[model samples]
Target: MMKLEGALYPWRFRVVLGLLGLMVAAICWRIIDLQVLDHAFLQGQGDARSVRHVPIPAHRGLITDRNGEPLAVSTPVTTLWANGKELQAGKDRWSALAAALGQEPKAFAARLEENAGREFMYLVRGLTPEQGQSVLDLKVPGVYSIEEFRRFYPAGEVTAHVVGFTDIDDHGREGVELAFDQWLSGVPGKREVLKDRRGRLIKDVQVTRNAKAGKALALSIDLRLQYLAHRELRNVVTEFGAKGASLVMLDVKTGEVLAMVNQPTYNPNNRRNLQPAMMRNRAMIDVFEPGSTVKPFSMSAALESGRWKPTDTVDVYPGTLQIGKYTIRDVSKNEGVLDLTGILIKSSNVGISKIAFDIGAEPIYNVMQQVGLGQDTGLGFPGERVGNLPNHRIWPKAETATLAYGYGLSVTAIQLAHAYAVLANNGRSIPMTMTRADGRVQDGVQVIPEATAKTIQGMLQQVVEAPTGVFRAKVPAYHVGGKSGTARKATVGTKGYTANAYRSLFAGFAPISNPRIAMVVVVDEPSTGAYFGGLISAPVFGKVMAGALRLMNIAPDNLTPADVQPAVAVTIPRGLAR
Candidate 1:
């Protein structure tokens, strides 16, 4: 069987050897391709499977008052997360994690079961440093944590209205927070995370972009002044048994708001007990028919328009002035003639009504509009209201007349204060602001001529200085100047004013020699025997003004009272009596 031709045997052996050589060459080519050409791609796939993105929370910015007092800040904390897939692989691992986190094992197991197959899941958020350490000590597989921040308010309820509060993600929600939210929310950063086979974060692989914190916001509020105003206003509210109260202090030099306070305020740190009404900033939002506070504007407009003089006398009927179908009456009986200054000192509704008719609505409306009434002050707020102003075109005969005596129009406390500040600044109506910027007046648009403004200022001073006028507001050492207003509260169902409930307002500028601080105090529905501005709110004005001036280190106009004497007892005309 082995005896075959030599040529045939050799040919068959050569064929078999050639086929083996081809097979070996093919194997070598495959090995070279796999080892060299495809290595980078395989490596890239492995990296993708293991890599992750870990968010590094940036620190929130600080909020400080103008005096550099920290109002809001961020405290460092930790957030715990888990790898659902890895936790499932480790039996009872969830129970261990929950035990270390002080959570119930049953709840932890249920939560993990619900989130099975999830790549990443949060176990707990906002962990304290101590809690974080406990979690780290457990060394439980799949559990990871990273640093974060939580906002805090140092001043709490006292500064809540001004500093406002931020959301869980550190976004502003109210007050300065909302006004400057974009500036307060810093950009979050990202880093590459190294993960194990089961998508558990091992460590940060590389930082792609560093987190940038928000900018610190400096407010114009003075903490001391704010505290003072809050204390006194709260005292008065409790004394009068009022439902609530509001107080605001403005820098006369510029329309800067130094202190704005509202009662029933809520602490930003614990808002669970907050009331809806407590959150409203009444100084800027509440509108009332400024009562006698508006008399100065009327008297000023009349004197400025070259229509009346301080001594110019107008006959006021004993009881009422008949206009169209409505008869406008005074609070007290004054059957005689009253000069321009006398009308303001007496707060005669009938006298003011005659003057409003004399000046007409156009000029007064124009001046009021120019002085920032019936308009927004451009303050950064959520819901600022524009007070109502009766258009001259729509003003009926009675409406125009009533508007002169501080009726048929409405204004917020801030607007009244701003108008008084304009009078203090010698006729220039400066724009009001919340931020503590430059204190220089904005060269206010001169609504009334300088002469008219000065005259009104002199009359307003007399209202406080005169003996019979309403001397309840005079400070012992300071040269006080201001006006008192008592407008009846509007009845809900009917049209006429309520007899018992009245909005008492006293607005003025102090240190008449050189006005430093302007203030307006309005007490709504005061239950005390006296609801008139002169009796109720004017004294508060005097108290607050004296306190504010003393705090600001302003010298008194008269060290002693012999330099000035109580003028003639300018009894409030019977018609103007409330």
Candidate 2:
């Protein structure tokens, strides 16, 4: 019995020892992993949990008209997001989400089933507060919202071109939006939130960075003038059956862009049906051969160079002047030895061409170039064409003659108005500006002699006052002066030009005696009875100027003319002479 007891004891002891050995081995293995093998991995997990990240978008700035009227403003909106894993675990998820968010069930289901392995997904953008509350009320797990800004244009399509539009991300897309995007787009701020072990939010850990708001921009454009310009331009476009039209009103002394309007415009807010063509701002973007309107430049060039006086007569034959293969003629039958003033009054193409040949192409090109023709005005608008000006070498004899009368070359409405403003402002050429950055007026360079500018101003006055030009473009309160331009439109599919289709242009400034403002009006392809610039564009110019004058509070210069009355005495003796 003693021997049996000893053997059993030995067996029990070996079994107990084996169990202890196994326990020690397991503990050692775990210690090695915790101390060495898995140490780096565990460290990384901790660091990731402690560190937080958030997005920052620069808030865009405010855009206001000259009168401090808000044209564009940014309003806060909610963007919906979802945690895929959490959302998938929710009961009756798809139907609840669709009902809460006002989306189709099928679409919402498809979105959930999408295989983007991301933990988060965007459900929708630009949500109203009500929509956000509805989603939160659904109690669907993992769905959340973030705040963002959506731009709003108060004046709508009326100022579409001037105000421009921004993208979904609040980036400026076109017009003033693009021009001042950098200055206006503010920096964004961010914060980190701490979450408990079960992924429940604790509190905002810290504000990582503070976001900066964008700068506000104030334009030199007057909202009232802009409205007026739009009204007149729209009416003319309807009445004339024209394809499109543009108008620019400028401050002669300051070179401020008071008003610019383009027809065929679309609402910046509703961009679903926007056409690429309609999106363009034609005043600065497009250029055309400015027919008779250019004749003044030819005359100005001659007068500036002292080659001809305003009274100097050119024996312009009854009609056409044959140059190489081209024949240029007077638009009117009343042609003779015309003085420089008469040439412009009748819009004599032949007379101007003769003077251009006398002055020579090189000299004329130089003069035109100096006066801002065929040059970019640097208005900061995208896609501005410098227009077409043939080099001295390629200028055919006919080319020179044609260009002399505002053909064979092209100029923008902005460029034309700026050039005309030089005459209105006494020969000083100021840079065209949309912003009032440094001051309202910038120093101007003298392009034409003061005397020469005055002479041209006096001559252009006849274009409004003469019987032939009496279409009601005349301003009774101010001595206004400017010329009209009519150019044939080029065919779209071919290089050939058409006679009936014309781009009518009127470039002038008012209170001409002591001019304060300059403007340019261009109507493209008017199909109505009135196609001439003098007929279609001039009356609009007159109306716009009258309104602007009253707005500026510039008292009437021609009070005598306004107040004058005829003596009304009877002529007694003259009837019997026959």
RMSD of each: 9.8, 8.8
Question: Each model's TM-score, in the order given?
Answer: 0.84, 0.87
Cα lDDT tens digits, model 2, 425-533, are: 8888888888754355667888888898888888888877777763467886677888887899987787979868999889888886688899999999999897888
Q: Pick the candidate with the highest TM-score.
A: 2
- lDDT (CA) per prediction: 0.79, 0.83
Clashes of each: 10, 3
Candidate 1 lDDT, 360-440, residue by residue in tens: 877777777777777787886766678898786566768777777777788888888888888888888777777767455
Question: Residue 341 error for model 2, in Å?
Answer: 1.4
- Model 2 quality (TM-score): 0.87
Of candidate 2, the 10-residue stretch with the lowest lDDT total is: 1-10
